[model samples]
Target: MATKVKRARKANFSDRECVKLLDIVDANIGKLTNNNNTLRANAGKKAVWKMAAQELSAMSLVQRDEEDCRKKWRVSSLIGPTVTL
Candidate 1:
């Protein structure tokens, strides 16, 4: 049997702190994907790659917005929210 370590909530990271995340997402999307699948075609691969890159960038923006909203809420003294791990 193995022991488990308690996980703590991640402190909200700001936009500037999320630079590496976009790079990692871009570099890893196809790395974990099965490109041989039929939903993706050979000629369309480049376009798909570009779209994935854009999507990851958009996700970074979304994360920043979400963190900002959460921080604003906390600053306003909102509570009764239980963060689940």
Candidate 2:
């Protein structure tokens, strides 16, 4: 019998990639807001923008988690309570 081990897949993406995606979303949003008939009529662009927003949000969450982990691993000194005369 063979045992299968589940491995966690990394969701790491380069900052450049995230920035590019955000740029695309911003452009699309601008187009949609400009009353551009072509862009307004295209449902696909809206879907793409939604997906990009989701991706950006996910990346932000990942970054926050990494920062929290790093903070957790740091050594901290405990200060004794101060007494006032």
Candidate 3:
């Protein structure tokens, strides 16, 4: 009898591959930071911006309405945080 090991299914990505892929993407997308922590932090921010517009567009009912997205993406609440920057 042969013993078999079960592996979990992933979204076609691996930890080792993820790190290398991140490194490459980060290098191409932005300047490298002085430290690993700073590099990672900045990379996270970049990832958010990269996916947000695309995500909003996809999730939105009005696919052709970029203006609707710009409005919807904002914090419409008066007491909420404003886009000062």
Which segments of model 3 are wrong by more than 4 Å? 1-37, 61-85
**Which candidate order results from sorting by lDDT in descending order?**
2, 1, 3
Model 1 per-residue lDDT tens digits across residues 1-85: 8999999554454443334333443465564344675644543444544444454446564433333432433453355323322
Model 2, residue 11: displacement in angstroms?
Answer: 3.9
Q: Give the C-alpha miss distance for residue 64 in model 1, angstroms.
A: 16
lDDT of each: 0.44, 0.45, 0.41
**Candidate 3 lDDT score at position 41:** 73
Q: Worst lDDT window (10 residues) for model 3?
A: 62-71
CA displacement after TM-score superposition, residue 33 of candidate 1 (Å) = 3.4
Q: Name the better of 1 and 2 by lDDT.
A: 2
* Count: clashes, candidate 3: 0
Look at candidate 3 and tell me the lDDT of residue 44. Answer: 64
Q: Evaluate residue 10 in candidate 1 and report its C-alpha lDDT on the 0 to 100 scale.
A: 45
Tell me, what's the RMSD of every candidate? 13.5, 15.4, 18.2
TM-score of each: 0.26, 0.32, 0.28
Pairs that collide in candidate 2 are none
The residue-by-residue lDDT of candidate 2 on 14-51, one tens digit each, is 45534545355456655544555575465654565555
**lDDT, candidate 2, at 4:** 97
Show how many residue pairs clash in every candidate, following the order shown.
0, 0, 0
